[model samples]
Target: MSENLWEHRPESGYVTGTDLAGYRVEAIDGHIGKVDKHTAEADGANIIVDTGVWIFGKEILLPAGCISAVDHPNGTVFLNRTKEDVKGAPEFHRDHHTEAPDYRLTLGDYYSGRVL
Candidate 1:
């Protein structure tokens, strides 16, 4: 995983404090879902996408580094990953997601192209 996996890329156009909730999240191939929640923490930035109906109401947590761009005008957040990649990610456990170090490491590894 990138050392900066939790930090937003400078070229992603993600302005700090920007409200990303409700913004559409698009994978490399197609649309995935909307942002259910997010954080702009300097080191732990991430977004929780609620994949309504598309994945049977699954929610996935993506590190900021996965974002390729943020089109504020269009209300879309584009990701470098594909739908299959996102779908194959570690199951999101809401209760432990935010505070678990293991979860973060696993997610980081997944996004870094390491076999899970």
Candidate 2:
């Protein structure tokens, strides 16, 4: 996985300290869901999307690197990934999704194209 996979790109329009909760998450294909939670840690930024009925309410974690842009004005976050990409990610485990290194690696690998 890439070293910067967890850091938002400079051009992604994500301002540090910005609260992304509730922002609509849009994949390359279409709307996926809303942001249930987010983190802005310098080395561990990411978003947890609540997929609602689209995937039986499954929540998926996406690395900041997948974000192509953040439209705060419209309350939407654009991702470079497709809907299938987000859908195929590991399911969010509320208990260990945040602090688990293995979980992060799995996510990073999935998003970085290292894992199929």
* Best-matching candidate per lDDT: 1
Q: What tens digits encode model 1's per-residue C-alpha lDDT throughout 34-60?
A: 999988887789999999998999899
Model 2 TM-score, all chains together: 0.92
- The deviation in Å at residue 19 for candidate 2 is 0.5
lDDT of 1 at 52: 95
Off by over 4 Å in 2: 1-3, 114-116
Write down the lDDT of every candidate, Cα atoms only. Answer: 0.89, 0.87
Which portions of model 1 show Cα errors greater than 4 Å?
Answer: 1-3, 114-116
Q: Ten-residue segment with the worst summed lDDT in candidate 1?
A: 107-116
